[model samples]
Target chain A: MNEHSLTAEIIAILRKAPSVALFSHVSPDGDCLGSMLAIGLALESLGKTVTFFNPDPVPAGLTFLPGAERVQQVLPQPKPQTLVFVDCTDLRRVSLTPDYLRDSIVVNIDHHISNQRFGHFNWVDDQASACAEIVLSLINQLGVTINRDIATNLYTAIVTDSGCFQYSNTTANTHRLTAELIEVGLNLALIHHNIFDQKPLAQVKLLQAALNTLELRAGGRLAVMSLTLEDFQKSGAQQELSEGLVNHARSIQGVEVAVLLKEVGPQEIKIGLRSNLWLNVNEIAAQFGGGGHKRAAGCTLNVSLAEAKQGVCQAIEEGLEIGRDH
Target chain B: MNEHSLTAEIIAILRKAPSVALFSHVSPDGDCLGSMLAIGLALESLGKTVTFFNPDPVPAGLTFLPGAERVQQVLPQPKPQTLVFVDCTDLRRVSLTPDYLRDSIVVNIDHHISNQRFGHFNWVDDQASACAEIVLSLINQLGVTINRDIATNLYTAIVTDSGCFQYSNTTANTHRLTAELIEVGLNLALIHHNIFDQKPLAQVKLLQAALNTLELRAGGRLAVMSLTLEDFQKSGAQQELSEGLVNHARSIQGVEVAVLLKEVGPQEIKIGLRSNLWLNVNEIAAQFGGGGHKRAAGCTLNVSLAEAKQGVCQAIEEGLEIGRDH
Candidate 1:
């Protein structure tokens, strides 16, 4: 369906629905959690029963969202008349049983270009910076007065998904909508600090360990960093804290491609690749039986850390050469 | 003068001036640099001879600004008809000879709360998030169309001064202006990447060394980190790279006060202090012959690093105790 008609259909179904259930991808981040909460709160305000479901618990950093505590692991009873999937590119990402909800009207709302139209009503806009941006438009169309609490949730979603407005996906309309949301009295600092700052001591320790092993290749064009299992144990940091570590390597002045290899087991390693402008790491991840976006991609290699590092760095060098030639 | 009349007076002067000279504080930050460039570019487009002056060279990160190369270290000849001091809390900050332009009409434009209004026309609005915001208004009132270059400069000013819109000073108007600037075809990601993401490898090395010495004082209520001159020399990092090191310490989960002591010489030490919520560090800095806002402050001590750290940490502990009692 065209975006206009799909949006209208979704709105029409939502307005008359007796109950609505919201599902987001597993291991939800700020965008999914904030989008779910904002829409659920809006529906509740309209006197409709709303159930928010997440396959995995909200990450530690994003629990501050207003309605985060209400997210349930299992689908609620009294089957929802309307099922809205937000921020999930694939239906399996939601990790919910597909058999029971066959009768309900399905609505897929996402901002990802890769979103599969797994719903009866699909409204996907790749240009939207975040799913929350789409939700904001829907709320405005529904004539719902966005209260302060709802505004805060929406703001969190945009800020996190846009990397606090630093990402390329952030557009002019993103800032305009953010301005309108702030008008509803959002505390930009409190939310920003709680989300970006307030890092645990262990995280910094892990960062230190990760940087200690930093290496440069391709005449400073490639930056490689690694963390052994021992480093995580020594720092008392969980493996999750290693997230964004490769970005550190990519931040180097002359580096184009950054790779991080983490030892998950004695002979197993997880490889992450990040590129600055030109190099496409997704193809490199595909060779390793995984894939992601152009600038960021990842894969798991059942090889020793040293072997994985050598193979990934060689692949990135070839990619960079190809990119330069192009 | 009231803010309304002050803004009107400045606008009137700019409209009629044959030429204008722009002055920002020495060691200019993103806000000052961005504000100066935006206004100067706008005036230059109006066929006015504009001279942009800064006592210190543009910092490495901000040299990406469009007009950064045009900023002069020394005063230019044929004095301008109008002298506009932007982003300066005090006249001395501009560091220009006081006698050279004593008779010129001085316009002080700032957003700092402590501005002294030391200008024939003063437009100081602390409520405005950044001085760049004020410049945006003045350009609009002057009826100058904001081009892509001017928009980039103004956006840089706001993003830097507002800490990427995370600081408390950011308001609804800030985002609105940012959205307008974005509409002018500013590349948000390129500017953000150049300003925030492109850190030198030396800076990361310096960070590693500083984190190695991370110390917790006052029973974990205070976190302290120190780096000696040798550490800078060995890591190939300059003293300026230590600007935000204290923020890392302040980010610890429970730490109320975070301090960074840098050895400037055998005896002199440069100190930076940051507070999360309670316990005013500015008062503590004042006790040591320095002062600033309640949360972030700085000072210099002509004592050994060991002595300075001990004294400052004790003062912070006492302040925390007093704050708790209150």
Candidate 2:
């Protein structure tokens, strides 16, 4: 079915459901949480009972999102007949057992191209920058006015996923949808502050420690930054706080490949790979039993930090060399 | 006159002009350069002879902009009859004397609220997120079809000035204009890379050195990060590379006031101030013989870096106390 008709059918299904349970992916990002909450708020306004669930706690920076408090960590007893999975590539992404979905009419809404279409009704739009874009369309079709709260949720989703409209996923429709969200009286200044500006002190300290280990190799074609366990402990930062440190290395001028190795355990290192233009980091990552997209990928090494660094750097060097011949 | 009629009048004026000279402000940023180039490209399409001038050289990152090579440093001996200033707040901002303007029909196009309107024809839309927005409208009115080159220029202007659409100045119109620009087939990914991702290695090193000096005071509300002359030397970075370091301090979670003190010379320190929520930083800055907007400001002190830090910290503490009483 065409997207327009599919959207109509999803809206019809949602309208007829007495109660809907919305689930977000594990370690939920702004896109997932915001997408789930936006749709949940819209359904509630339509006089339907809505329950929101996420396997992990919402990140501190995203707590300001309206309806965030309502997202429970544990699933409620007697699961609703209708289940909606928002921003999940598949059921496993939510870290929930598939048994519950057996009897429920599953509706999947996501923007990931890899979505498995696990839902009885799936609306997967890789072209949409964020699932919030799809949710916004659904809300409009549901005849629910996008209030400040709904607008805030949807706006946050789009901004975070689109890297504030810097990512390649951002399209003309992303900006148009943002324009509509801004028209709904969303306090963009405050939203931007709460979402992006409010970085934890620990994260900043972690970044400092990570930058201290910056190394450039492969004739400036490869940049590497790593944070040992001691670095994390000294900064009072959790492992997850090092999420975007690889981007720092990736952003350096003249660097084609950026690598970030995190000493997560005594003999275990986590590796992140990012390539700017030519080198395929995913291919390098897959060699280490990790895989993702062409530009970004990751792997885990059950070796010392030094060994992991040496191995990854050598692989990246080879990758860069191969890229040059092309 | 209303903006519509003013835009129409300016379009009419440009349509009739035989030749035009475009000027950008000193220390040109993406917005000023992009705005100038976009207009220049559009005028060239109209078969009007166009010349671009800037008092300063275009920054290395902005050199990728189309027609960037054409931005001349010195004003031509015989200036074009029609001289247009793009993104200049005042005539002096271009850093050229008014002597050149005496014989030319000056057209002032800008988005700054403080625009002096020093033009026989002026279109200063303070509401615009970027001067490029105004230029985009002018180009459209001039009946120029926005190709990839013009679109890239305008897109860069909007993206940079809007802080990638995170700033408060961004409006529905900003995003709407961006939607139109994206439809013109501009490569969003490459543009983002050129504008933001390609940080100089020296700048990254400077950031590392600055972050090492991060200190919290006034119950963690005031965060200060300073860089000594030695720090700059060690990083091999220039003073201009420290431009956004203050924002690192400002982005801390509990930081209401953030300051970056750069030891520019012996016994000379440059102070940048940014306030997150309340605390009027401009007021604090003015106490030290510097001033800007409420949330952001700057100052210079002839005292030692230590003395400067102490004085600024005390003033910001008092400002925060005053903010609390309100």
Candidate 3:
């Protein structure tokens, strides 16, 4: 089966199966749910029996995705000969699988460069903006309908993955695909608001706390903000609600780099990085066993938040050598 | 006093002036304040006596811009040779200017394509994205020293005028100029929050009320939501707080056109328009004597809320014939 070729691969396996199970990685993002739902909707239009699954509940923010209600938290038994995972690199990221389908023929689709070759038919193309991009490529190849519903789902994936087309990762192909999506009548306003604007009152309160903690460092070249578990609890903020606070640091004038260290658990911390110039954050992240792109990247440390912050600061200090006056 | 000429125009006048008074448009946006403030700062740096006046209080949201506190609500009594106006096309829009300056030479600089050529020495370069963009070009010509504060203010002007580089008006010059501003170390994070992300609780509540009234029209191609004066008063939403609301209307799936009409006064309404493919809202707005570029536009109607809605809907209906498919 031609699993590596996005369209031929999805078609090759589903051609033989009377029923198919579709799913995504847990803690679903717009790319994960959007790709899965858009593909599931397209496949369902083709008279194919499709069951969609996710390991965890979809975040409330992404509930507007097409076919969202059809997705279940786990795969069921009596699964067909085909199982397709959209935006998931491996089964470990999936919450549950039907016992009988543990050994079922699996197809994996994703846009993560770190994707592990984890399935019988894996098509991982990181060049695409999102899994939804690959899904649309396949659907178009299969001559499936590109209606408003599918257009919305695909638009969501692209917009989310592109950071509304402001992130450095956006390429010419991203714009081309976006133009095509626009041709299909994508609603730019709704997608922007539903995904980026639907912040709760709790999130704003969280931002207030984060803003209060902003510190200027490195001769005003580095801006850092942090959140202790206590801060989160007091603000009634969840990890998700902490979105866009690091942006405050990166937003300051003269700051070359911005860092956010959040205490995720009792002794665990996650670092988020953003830069205005040549700080190779991906290199910094790799020094700590995490990796991502140049302008933005992240890492996690097993140590307490304080130690993790110090470690991140060290990485940033070294990174700034390459960043200044270049 | 040849303001429109690249020749020794404002330069000659400023060199002879003992002191200068500057102001910006009414309903001041970032571009207006940022451009005026930047010019004021640069002139002050050059050992020129300057007093910046703004009759209206800085809109609560824009207080984060540097040197905002230095802007006075009332101009100090002083005889000045020239009064500089920024970003405004009409004399009616001047916020804070001494009545004595009406006899002095007026130097009006703007980027409004529709500017009526209303000043003694008017330089209106509508091709520029913002008045700040024009200011930057003029400053470079004058060999004025540009520093971080000036750059930060200039950056705000372009970012706001270009809608953070997402509006159709964004150009190669916009990006190039922004890239230069970033090199000077402007805090885009604070700028974004101050200009884009800072929403009052009342505005949020007003948004919820607006979203509650969303409806799909024109064969699932038009989405609309409106606000009565009651809605704004109940939520304490000020006129400036309605900045990004039109975007909400254009976000609905399958929406080709979006309309947002708000009560501007007890008996008047203001209309905002946005179009995806297959709609031309600019032409509709033109019928009411308002003009803007295609894709987005606005108009004001002196009618009761009910009559305004009827008139706008009729125009939208009449203008649909020319809406594009791609």
Give the winner by DockQ. 2
Poorly placed runs, candidate 1 (over 4 Å) = A217-219, A282-293, A299-303, A310-323, B1-5, B215-222, B267-271, B283-290, B298-325
lDDT of 3 by residue, A108-154 (tens): 88888888767777788888867877888888876787888898898
**Candidate 1 recovers what fraction of true contacts?**
0.73
Better lDDT candidate (1, 2)? 2
Interface C-alpha RMSD per candidate, 1 decimal: 1.6, 1.0, 9.0
List ranges where model 3 is wrong by over 4 Å.
A1-6, A96-103, A263-271, A281-326, B1-326
Give the range where candidate 1 chain A is weakest over 10 consecutive residues by summed lDDT. Answer: A95-104
Docking class of 2: high
User: What are the per-model DockQ values?
Assistant: 0.66, 0.85, 0.05
Give the DockQ-based CAPRI class for model 3: incorrect
Name the weakest run of 10 consecutive residues (lDDT summed) in model 2 chain A: A317-326
Ranking by TM-score: 2, 1, 3
Clashing pairs in 3: A189-B251, A190-B251, A251-B187, A251-B189, A252-B187, A253-B187, B221-B256
Candidate numbers, best DockQ first, in rank order: 2, 1, 3
lDDT of each residue in B154-259, candidate 2, tens digit only? 9999999998888889999999999999999987778888887789899999999989899999899999999999999998998988998889889899788899
Ranking by lDDT: 2, 1, 3
The clash tally of candidate 2 reads 0
Cα TM-score of candidate 3: 0.53
